[model samples]
Target: MKRRTLMTSALALAVFAAVPALAVADTLDDIKARGTLRAAIDLGSPPFGMQDANMQPTGSEVESAKLLADHLGVKLEIVEVTSPNRIPFLLTNKADVVVASLSISEERKQVIDFADPHGVIQVIAAAPKDVDIKSVEDLKGKDVATTRGTTNDKEATTQAKDANIVRYDDDATLVTALVSGQNNIMISAPQIMNAVNERRTNDPLEVKFVLKVNPYAVGLRKGEDALKAAINDWVKTDLANGKLNAIYKKYNNVDLPAEMPKP
Candidate 1:
């Protein structure tokens, strides 16, 4: 009877020991254990993530990542990604979370999960405020600059059939071309549009026409409920406390919508 009892007690201890290993399998636990949060951000996209006048990284997304890392109680390791590779980096374990301006879509949902939307991005045709681009017809025979593999690319390639679409790998390159007078018209968000004006005062850019507005959210891996729930809660708390809104306004120079769209 004593031998049988000892065997059962050993078996129970073994099972209990395995529980912690299983718990740590979640990405959230892994991040904590690693003592660093790998946040993927697209530094090329201003107001989201970009360098300041001193070439130091500073933007809404950069701050957002900082907030997230703070909440996680871990050090932040920014994994810079372009629009095309953001999702890939997350899926391949190169990043633990994607805080880039990743627009939530049914198509993207099919691959990975997203937390509640933190903000919205408007895709539009923009040019110098002096240029009158009242309609798509006004874009005829013009060169349109846009970042490749982005919703902007899809919108421009689909809508502006007559214009020559010039695609770059990222927003920074595309914006540089615009500021240098290589392309007068381009598809971009209000954040980038405003950035253009700050850099090129002579030809202040303005939205010619809006293409679409999409709610952007943090990207997480599918089946990682722990990580997803943590981010969702973080977004909810910060959004309610006005921290997220304050950060958004500080960089984007605009307030987040009063009624945020559902993710």
Candidate 2:
């Protein structure tokens, strides 16, 4: 009887030890208590997130970040991040979340979680209007430029057979290459191409073709259920009430997407 009771007690203790402990609590609750939600944003890209004349961050993405901070009832802290460092920033806790124009990819899913898709973008190829380029096949053995460390690079590499791919950190360098006749063509987001065209109407480049379409989303650390849930809820509410759509249209001539889909 003594041995049986000892075994039973040991089993009970094992079961008790196995009980799951919820150590990390709700992100929204924690943010509210802390009074600040740090959002890592890409200030290099225009019409999404960029610095103004006074060097203040302002754009559709910035406004969305502000709205999210407000919804969480905390102050908004914006950290300017680049394409290469955005994911790392979130993983290292340098920023609580990311609102960069981060495209959803299977490779990235291994390291971070993404919110619902907020924007749909297409990879468009452009060159001088006088050029006779008509399709992706025409770029064979030619050089193509795109923003470094972006979805555009992924698609460009896959679609452009036997083509030399050059990547720049931002639009300015990519555009400069094409204008200076250093590259045969340039590939980037359609909205960004449109912006470049609008800025230089007199010397505009032509879009030859759209390679592929993808969606952009906010990113958080993987396994952070609390943070992911809070962002998902916030996105759903914003999309349903037309807040998300309005923000995009208000900032640029592009129309807002009808719905925010899961990427």
Candidate 3:
């Protein structure tokens, strides 16, 4: 009788212990109970997430976040975060989820769960208005500038091994280097290039030779199966309902792919 009782007690304890992690018990639940869902984002990347001249957060990710929060019947809170800090922010419970422009990668999958990709971005070469550069190959032996610690830097280094690939701490400095003639071409996403061109009156910089295509998704902490599934299901529904495409089209001139890439 004691053995049976102990087993019962243990099972009860196990069930109780799982309360904090249950899909019905996680931050998603807390948000439903408390009535607000907070998200973390990198505000520097425009058309994805960024502040306008009025300092209000506006972009594809931001609008999607708002839509999700609304669908969940909760208020939405925005937390500013950088690329390097996104995982840490989610892991530490600083945010309920991350709507940042985080790339979905196998390496990252080991640490965090990713939702169905909502958009695709690519790294390409951006050159001055009159520069004769035609492709990534033309960048051979020329100077290339890319943002430090980004996929841009890695791709640039690999494609232009002999070219001087300089890394800047931020996009601003990288563009500054390019505009000042310290670098010949810049490696970055077309969205970022568009942001730069918006500020420059001298016609938009030309982009060419797409190096790599990156799909972006919302990120969640690992081990949150319920939350992950819920978020994924929500994304799928949005896609089916045409809500996802509308959000992306509202912010970017580019269109999003209809389905997530296969694993």
Candidate 4:
């Protein structure tokens, strides 16, 4: 009877010891154990996340993800995702975190959590230098191009109800429509539109009006407080150390605003 009691106590203590390990098993632990951080990015959006001339993923968001991976001392696995799929990728566990140019919105908050603002992105209207689109109202009766189902599209549709809004499949296609003169104006992030204009000296596009100022943030799966805190801590450290500013300047050709908001 004493031997049986001793065996039971030993088993209980062993299980108690294992419980703590299981309790602490979280996304961060899984990431560390896997030795790779999977970062979802919108590879089509230049200056934020895009492929470089060598076909390697290179952009501000890509660099930011790299920074996180380096901070965690792990390799980065780039997962290409579209704007609409960023949340789905995270929820489905296909991506550990989304480094896409994701703007924080209340609707999205219901499903996923966001880290502090990593950068500020301006959604603006761009037009050929000769075009006279100076404001949202100026877009009336004009052909404006934007990606379907994006904030730009929603804002343009709402503000310029009478405008001939042309919807494209993605930002690349929308920019193509604008540059090809299929559309008189395009609403997009300033970084990408400016880059496109810089490449086209024949017909340079200029930002006519700023529509929205969005705080871009990293998206993580819901309920992952540890992961979220780690990401925010990394952002805070990098922001103070000028690492984020350097990355932003490298891709966007401008420094990140000193007063950029934190989480």
Descending-lDDT candidate ranking: 1, 4, 2, 3
Give a tens-digit lDDT track for model 4, residues 53-167: 8999988899999999998889999999877677888887798898988887777788888999888888899887888877877777877788776677777788889888888
Question: lDDT for model 1, on a 0 to 1 scale?
Answer: 0.87
Model 2 segments more than 4 A misplaced: 1-29, 175-184
Which parts of model 4 are misplaced by more than 4 Å? 1-25
Q: What is the per-residue lDDT of model 1 for residues 1-263, given as tens digits with 9 covering 90 to 100?
A: 99999999999999999874465348898899899999999988987998879988788989988988888789989998999999999888899889998988877899889988988899999988788898778888888899988878888888888888999999888888888898888887888878777788887788888988989999988877888888888888899999999999998778999989876
Give the TM-scores of the predictions, in the order they appear: 0.86, 0.84, 0.81, 0.86
The candidate 3 region of ten consecutive residues with least summed lDDT is 171-180
Candidate ranking under TM-score, highest first, comes to 1, 4, 2, 3
Q: Candidate 2, residues 78-185: lDDT per residue as tens digits?
A: 988877788888777788888977889888888878888776667888876877788888888878888887888888888886778888887556655655557657
Q: Which sections of candidate 3 miss by over 4 Å?
A: 1-25, 170-184
Backbone clash count, each prediction separately: 0, 0, 0, 0
Q: lDDT score, residue 82, model 4?
A: 78
* lDDT of each residue in 11-119, candidate 3, tens digit only: 9999998865674346667788889888997776677877788989988889888878877788999988765577788888889888976777777788888877777
Model 4: clashing residue pairs?
Answer: none
RMSD for each model, in Å, please? 6.6, 4.9, 4.5, 6.4
What lDDT does model 3 reach?
Answer: 0.77
The lDDT per prediction is 0.87, 0.77, 0.77, 0.82
Q: Give the TM-score of candidate 4.
A: 0.86
